[model samples]
Target chain A: MNNYERYMGMVKGEQVDYVPRIPILMHYAAKHIGASYADFAGDYNTLVKANIALAEDFGVSQLDIMSDPWRETADYGAEIEYLETTCPQCLKHPLEDSKDLSLLTRPEVGKTTRLTAAIKAIEAYKAYGYKEYSITGWVEGPAAEASDIRGVSNFMIDLIDDEEFACELMDLCVDVAIEFAKAQIAAGADTIGVGDAIASQMSADMYERLVFPREKRLVDGIHEAGGLVRLHICGNTNHILPVAASLGVDIIDCDWMVDVVKVRELFPKNTVIAGNLDPVEGIMESTPEKIHQNFIDLYHKVGNPYFVNAGCEVPMDTPKENLQALCKPIQYNSSI
Target chain B: MMDLKDLTEAIKTGNRTQATSLTQEALDADLTPQSILDAMVVGMDEIGDKFKRNEVFVPEMLIAARAMNESMAILEPSLVKSGYKPLATAVIGTVQGDLHDIGKNLVSMMWKGSALNVIDLGTNVTPDKFVAAIKEHDAKLVGLSALLTTTMPSMKATVEAIKSEELSDVKILIGGAPVTQSFADQIGADGYSPDAASAVDSAHQLLGIR
Candidate 1:
């Protein structure tokens, strides 16, 4: 089966040729194509080229349009500083003052430069007829987007002191995200990746009360748009896994700090659970043999409906052979 | 007549206004600034323990830290007037190529709550800046932070840059989401803490203090 069919089969709990590999790559992909992160993030053609090249060469199951967390934030009137090699930084958050929420206006996703670039990349992927691989479009999750719009430190304070304001801000972010996800789906993305790394830092109670419902809304919106949702929240999400599992997303990414067995137990049996590996220790520093063994161990614990990926973005400096080991297929034993 | 317990409770609950008022009242009652500061530390220590136990989280820790900071603002003049000196000096920042500062900020606040002098270089700090801060402050400890796998190389480079200076007296402590004890050893970091609360203990250990 092609990568697309393999992914569909695995997600559906049906038989597949092998486990699908869907590691999130950003700076790493830019390096793979020998392009600066700035150019790769700015130009849709370069972004598409880098993703397609990595997908073809490494046998990756999906091509992600994830360059950095600031894409949607930048389009929302925040001042973003783009570095030559590093992910762009949000210099001036639009909602620096929580009261400035009234000043904020959601940009038209199809018209904004950054969002349009991502949509155009998805269009390019479809134009290139890379139907065998799943093409993913990404948007910031409510909490993460709120953090981006109002600096992370400031937003965390908002969650405590101004619950109403925080909820209002998150609502705006979810609305924008829904629109952006729909635009990308219309532009040919099969999956929408929602990144909410900031949500992991909150207590389980806070997440359930403040963040989870917004996330559920975003997931429901994507499903309504005829696209699958891949939720990637980087960091230790063990405390919030129960709530996260309730979002009904197609895939849930567990970071290295979470126990894979616990995650498997918390999540539904058929939901595609991806990763719980330390990107630094499990993939970057380990030998190819060790990396493969790690994957095998994780696969054994979680069983099928699993995707091979690191807990977070693949480090840019990770060895090619290590990643190759990750993408390499393993023979499944029916008895196990 | 001021109740130190009230001050402690204020800090613990992250009631910044109450903490500030209680601190002022304590000072007006002729309470020694050291004793008032100790009360705030007691509150922060409780918050740190709860954080380690997973009973609390970043928001709670941040609020408690804010309350402590507010009390400290009221107590600073008295502490200095009484010829107070920090336990020791430490320099801290997120390494180059990383802009995430929440973790680093927590560590810095914990160090200050523990009565250590902190020279914060903010985020995306280079190795040279770290070395310079250490030299300038005569700091005994250097804390490095990074939140991205992509910036781990920069952490390694920063560590190498500090080591090259042969600052044998300096101890390097690193922490972040992607950082590990093994990675710390691989990069020649003197110490690593899994979380910000433990970072205080790690800093104390590295400095040969309780």
Candidate 2:
């Protein structure tokens, strides 16, 4: 089976020839193609070229529009500034100085914007896939999108002090994100990656009461749009793992800080857990042999329906040999 | 007639108004500014310890810190009038090519709560800027944060730059998502913190302070 089928089969609980690697590789992918990060996030052609190159090189399973988090925020009247060597920065948070819900109006999903570029990129992936590789479109989850527009500190304070405003803002974020996910699915994306890294830092009570329902709606919306869901939350998520898993997302990405063994305890045998490897120590700073061994051990520990990946995005300067070791195929083992 | 216990409880629960007013009440009751400050610090330390153990997360820590900050605003003028002095001065910033600063900002607030005088240099700070700030402030402690591995080399360069300046007394602490104790040792940082809560302990350990 091809990479796409392998991933889909894994998700569908069918036996795959081997586990598929789906490491989010934005900066590293751009570096592979010798393109500045500005070009990578700005032009969908560059974004697709880089992700495709990495997949060809490292046997990555998905072609994702994972350049940055500002795509959805851009549609919310935020001014994003692209840098040559780093992810684009949101120049001005639309709601930085205030919590005015009236300031937000949802953007038309297909209108010309960062997201438009992403949909075009998804179409390119579909054409290139020849109905094989999985094509991924991304959206900021409610909490992350709210953080992007309101600034992290401001949004955190809002979550504490003004629950009404925070929920309203997040509701709006989920609405825009659902329409954007649908547009991406219409553009031939087979998967929608929801990034809610902000939720990783939230209290279980706060996340459960406020963010989870909205995130559940977004995940449900994507599923309704006929797209698989990959939930990516960077950093330690020991607090909200249960609620996050209950969203019924197709895949849940575990960061390095998350104990995969513990994550396995929370998820069923058929659930797809992408990773729990430190991008720095486990892969980037490790030798090929050590990395190969690491992947082998993580695979066994995590059991079947697993994806080879770092806890987060592959670091920019990770050795190509180390990645080769990371993607080296391991025979499937059933946990059931 | 509410005592500093009420102030500590206020900060603990992140009740900013209560924290602020209780601190003022303590001062009005002829309680020493240092004692009132100590009460607020006790509240912060409780929150910090809870954060370290994962009992509380950033939002709660921030709210608690905000409570402490509002209380500090009321208590600061009195403390200055009473000739208060911070434990030591610190300089902190996110290394160049990294704009993410929530962790750095948290560390700064925690350091401030710990009674250290912190000068925040903000995000995307260059190595030369770090050295300049260290030299200018005569800071005895510095904290460097970098969320990106690409900026890690910049962190190493900053450490080397600071060392090259013969600032032996200036202890350097490094922390971020990608940083580790090994990375810290390799880059010659005096200490490393895995999270912001542990950052204060790392800084205190590096500087040989409580």
Candidate 3:
């Protein structure tokens, strides 16, 4: 079976020949393709070249691509500040001085400048995917995209201080994301990766009230569009794991703190958990032996229908041998 | 209603009012300034542990640190008037190419609350900057943070430069998303903290403070 088939089969609860490795590799991919982070996020051809290079170099089973977190905010007319080495950042909040959700315009999914470029990239990548390799198109999740548009500090205070406005902003962001996800699916993306690293920081109560429904809607929308959904929340999402699982997302991409065993306990029998390894300490700092043992430990905790990956994107400076040990399968007794 | 457990719990949950009130109550009950400081440190340390275990996160940590700071503002002069000495002086910063200062800032605040004299170098600091800070502060403990993987090497290089300096006696601590204990040893750093809170314990242990 090709990598795509194996991943799909595992997600479908079918037996797979081996575990799949879907580590998030953005900066690393850009590094592999020898492209600047600027070009990688701004230009579609640069992103495509880097991603294709990443797939070949890392032997990753899936192609998941995201154009920095600024895409949605930029479309909403936020000022984006691009650095030489790092990902572009949103400079001004679109909803900063004015908390008026009514003034917010929902940009057409296919017409927004760079977002259209992202959709085009998805189309091009999906057109050439191997039968077994899954093609992933990405969109910022409601909380993350909301933070981009309405500033993180403002959103936090608004959650308690201006509840109605926060919900309205969330709804607007979700509508745009759903339409974007649908466009990506129509463009041939077989899977949609939702980048919602910000939502992981919310309290369980706030999450259930403000963020959960919008995430559920986005996941449901992707499923309705005939595409699989993978949710990437890159922080300690332990408190919201149960609610996150209940959102019915096909796959949950965890970061360092969400233990795989805990995820297995919380999620339904068939739900696939991608990762929870400390990207920096475990893979970037540790030796080959340490990395190998860490993987073995993870495998022991994560049983069948689990993919091997770090909690977040692999660091650009991650030792090559350490990364190899992470993706390379190791033998472990399943009875643990 | 206001007691030590309540105070610690307040600090843990980042409840500033309860923490401040309980701290005052503890002081009113003829508790020593050292006792209040110990309790505050213990509470902040517990918050740190929970953070390291991923049971808590930045917002909670920030509030708890803020609460502890508020209490510390009330307790510091008392500790000094009674002739209490801080454990040590620590200089901390985020290495170059990394703009993430939240974790670094939190750690610095926690250190300050723990009664350590912390000289914060802020974010996007360079090796020469660290060396200069070390020399200027005469700091015994130097803490470095790097949120980006690409900047982690700068952390290692900073450590290397410090070790090569005349005062190799300075204890070095490293953190951020990419730093690990193994990497700490690889770079010859004196300690590695998993999170901002753990940095407190590691700093204390490295300095033999507690």
Query: What's the TM-score of chain B for every model shown?
Result: 0.98, 0.95, 0.89
Evaluation by lDDT, superior candidate among 2 and 3: 2
lDDT of 1: 0.89
Which candidate leads the pack in lDDT?
1
Residue lDDT tens for model 3, A1-336: 778877888788776676788887777777777889898888888888887776676677777667578887888888877765677866677887888776665666667777788887877787767455788888898888877787765565566556887888888888888898888888878889998877766678778878899999988999999988888887667889888878888888878767778888888878888886778777877788888787777777787677788878777888778877777755323343
lDDT value, residue B113 of candidate 3? 71
Model 2 reproduces a share of the real contacts of: 0.58
lDDT of 1 by residue, B54-138 (tens): 8988888899989998889889999999999998999999999899999999899999989899999999998999999999999
Once superposed on the true structure, which residue ranges of model 2 sit more than 4 Å away at CA? A333-336, B148-153
**Considering only N, C-alpha and C atoms within 3 Å, which residue pairs clash in candidate 2?**
none
Scored by Cα lDDT, where does model 3 land?
0.79
Q: Which of 1 and 2 is the better model by lDDT?
A: 1
- What DockQ do you compute for every candidate structure? 0.74, 0.62, 0.22
Please tell me which model should have the higher DockQ, number 2 or number 3: 2
| Candidate 3: true contacts recovered, fraction | 0.22
